[model samples]
Target: MSPADTGASTTVGARLPASPDSPTDSRMAPGGPGYRRMSLALFLAGVATFALLYSTQALLPLISGEFGVAAGEASWTVAAATGGLALFVLPMSALSERYGRRTVMTASLAVAVAVGVLVPFAPSIGALVVLRAVQGAALAGLPASATAYLAEEVRPRALVTAIGLFVAGNSVGGMSGRVITGWVAQEWGWRVAVGVIGALAVACAVAFRLLLPAPRHFTPGSLRPRVLLGTVRDHLANPLLRRLYAIGALFMTVFGGVYTVIGYRLTEQPFGLPQGVVGSIFLVYLVGTVSASTAGRLVGRLGRRGALYLAGGTTAAGLLLSLGDRLALVLLGLVLITAGFFAGHAVASSAVSRTATTGRAQASALYQSAYYVGSSAGSTVGALAFHSGGWAGTVGVGLLAVLGVVGITLCGTRAARVAARREPVPAH
Candidate 1:
């Protein structure tokens, strides 16, 4: 929504401090108690949202068996939630902008946990899919609001580090959710596994609520359609922002596609690994936790453009490696790809917050919406590809997608350079 729609225009009296980095009000600093608390809250937010959302992923085989559905259909359990998250992210971001960040985020966590608590009780496959979709929609609140919250409240110099830590939480959460659920499902049954995850989500949600500091710098706005539409127009018109959004979409497509069917791939064929062993492969996500933090440092050292190029190259290399037939090579490839994915995501998301001139929440929301849309589409497509042509086809598609990302990013860079050259030089 537009600033006008936010009634931010009416509250123009509440202008941002002359310098964002130097807000008149006290802002959270890098190492203060408040800062640490905020980071922990966000980190737990990342954990709860991702863990609750993907908890069903590792149980697809068992779910399919109980539901009497195909793998692709079973995948809908994961897809439904992502689809719901994708659909509501923009609207939820608007809500957070209109109300307040901490309020929106805390509510999101509580609602997501509540919905997750209900999934184990779903009476049928259709009911479970419906509940998962609702759960996903509930989970949309965090990602939609987190980056914008960081942008508005954190010091500019410390922003990248904060984003990295938050994403590191996502990496750890995603990995742990799959591993825990997979192992638990093997022994106790899928219902018990999911119920345990929901319980964990409840605990994380409580921690998130207790630790999060309220937003000090946020200015609430009106949720008018005109304002929203105008804000969307501005971002879409920016060539660089458009390219960044595209990168988010393509990045997650490959990530989602690979992880969607990876369990099936490892368990079925030449590798012939057991379910728990298949789950262990996700431990590679710890590599992503490190790479995300490193990406922050890289951005500080090399700037966003340089960091993105390197991250994309790393992802491409990982995809190529995954084509190997040996089990060790496959695991190594997963580690590389997971690292590259988080690195690229951390950079791109921070870039969105940096790039937007206004409606920071909306910009972040748009990026997340694209991200989850890619996820939903990628999971389904990847499942279908794996079913048809095997892991070879899945990797092939991912490689092509990563290449497309590189091409777009490079083209955007060239355009920026050309635009720089065309600008008139100041008279000396």
Candidate 2:
């Protein structure tokens, strides 16, 4: 960040107005009802998007059985959305710069809702995948601005809390969507159950638009290829940011891969669970939600290095537990894996935001884009393994991925420590 640029944004941020209603906010001169509204909108969105998006996951076996597609092909129903989101994130970020975050995000939510409502009507598996792909792309904007909204609107002290709440929404949404779909599939049918979740998502989207406050500090984003590439290079060049991206990739890849096949696993052999039973498994996300909140305290005590190493090791343990044939072991393993992912992601996301104080939004955006890309890749690879090698193969790859995360953790911690030492102390 150049001095001129720093002065420009800081001057604007400093000029932010306060509401007359809240003397506390007026005293601190941070955000207003608008920022709070934005946060609320984002939180609700997390509930809707994840619920609607991953609802298909628990239904993977149903999709396979009904559509007569192979496990890998059915897996595309979920993977396609992730893949589309990966592609759309950057472009959506750019769109927000031009049209503004709230506008782009609201529109995106509407489109996603439309896609969800249309899902039950899809005549064939191919059509459903295509609609899912588009819906995934549409969802890209909501998550993209979600971070930018927080970073730009709230006080620095309050930003992490807001982000944490939004992520918590993701946990709740994912769990409910799967459970609802699974339960409904057991009683009604997969189409009606999934479609109802989608309808609820649409309602949530409308509420989001109505509730979210418009941006007060947003300026048009730069569309210049030169500037875009420069921003990309700047974030990528930062050692800590680079490592965080790598960690995000590794965790999501392995985590996504492992969970992607769980339905397949349960549907086979000793388990042979129904879709409702498979969906109930997502109740395990409750552990992940609890851990994500609790993990916040760890960053204050151990710092990123110790915290991340512990998390990576935890992730590995989770995968190892999944290798057991017993239902108890499988559930326990998933709980650990979800816990580790939330913890690791929380640490990594915080590290990246702190890496660049001025370009925080862009840095966070880059980080999230990599995160989803990892999800897409992981789901795809997990599908292939589930198809050919089965549970053991998926477990093998997941642990192997965690080993790489361990290496990244050691290397990154060493670098951050070196940088800390190199940073000069100012005279008191």
**Per-candidate total of colliding backbone pairs:** 6, 1
List TM-score per model, in order.
0.94, 0.90
lDDT of each: 0.83, 0.77
Tens-place lDDT per residue, model 1, 1-428, is 44322222111213455444554535567866499999888888888888888888888888888989887998899999999999998889989988888888888888888888789988888999999999999888889699888877776667778888899999888988888887888788888889988988888889988998877777887799999988889889987778888898888988988998888888777888877777778888899989987777898787777888888888878888888889888888888888888998999987787677588888889999888888888889889988899888788778877887899888978987897899899899
Q: Candidate 1 at residue 131, lDDT?
A: 96
Summing lDDT over every window of 10 consecutive residues in candidate 2, give the lowest-scoring window: 3-12
Highest TM-score: give the candidate number: 1
lDDT tens per residue, model 2, 1-428: 43222221121233344432234442112255466666667778888878866768888888888889987888888888888887888778777766777888888888888788888887889998998899889988877577776656665455545666677777778888988898899898889988889877887888888997666666676678787678778778877678888898888888788778988899789899877888889998887677665655777688668888989989999999988989999999999998888788777775565455444556767877788888877888888987789998888888887898899989977876797899789889
- lDDT: which candidate is best? 1
